[model samples]
Target: MRSLLVAVCLVLALHCGEAAVSCNTVAEDLYPCVSYVAQGGYVPATCCTGIRALNTQAQTAVDRQSVCRCIKSAIGGLSLTPNNINNALSLPAKCGVNLPYRISPSTNCDSIN
Candidate 1:
């Protein structure tokens, strides 16, 4: 019984690990862009790198939605103005990432796919 319980636990853990893109990962990937987004100037190469990386990482519909939600949530937590938000949204295109949807707190993650 103990062995069975251990197996179940392991399986559950593995399943949870594969659930979706983590918010922490999302935050880390976008960290370099915060300065560029908040302020105005030439966008950093590192920022573009992070944006491209995130675009590559979020492949599936579920993964995209997960990333979308994470981005939206993070945006809410920040004190960016409309110009800042515009900068953030424009980062993807500037970085050569063709995001399917806009990155705004108001975006509906459910319709990402």
Candidate 2:
């Protein structure tokens, strides 16, 4: 009984951890792209790396929606210009992620899935 309980707890913990996506993690991964996206400059290597990581990490529909929400919130908090928004929207294609939904302030995250 004790071993069964321990095994169940371990499985639950792992499942919960895998299902969680933190906003801070998304922000940190996307931070490197700010300058390039906001200034219309070349996409940096670090930004590509972060984009790929995010693409890989957000495999599920739920994860993708979470990422969209986090990105939308982050962009809202920033003072990015129109050019910046355009560049940022283009990052997924630039990085070859082929995201299903567009990344914009008005993107309905509920429709991402």
Residue-level lDDT tens digits of model 1 in 1-113: 24423332343233322326666666667777767776768888987887788788888988888778777766665556799789878888888889877878678988988
TM-scores vs. true structure, each candidate: 0.78, 0.77
- At residue 57, candidate 2 shows an lDDT of 84
Q: Pick the candidate with the highest TM-score.
A: 1
lDDT of 2: 0.69
Positional deviation of residue 112's Cα in model 1 after best superposition, in angstroms:
0.7
Q: After superposition, how far is residue 71 of candidate 2 from its true place, in Å?
A: 0.4
Off by more than 4 A, model 1? 1-18
**lDDT by residue (tens digit), candidate 2, 1-113:** 24423332343233322235656666667767767775666888888888888778888888888877777765655555688679989998888778767777878987977
**Local lDDT at 34 for model 2:** 66
lDDT for model 1, please.
0.71
Error of 1 at 27 (Å): 1.0
RMSD of 1: 11.3
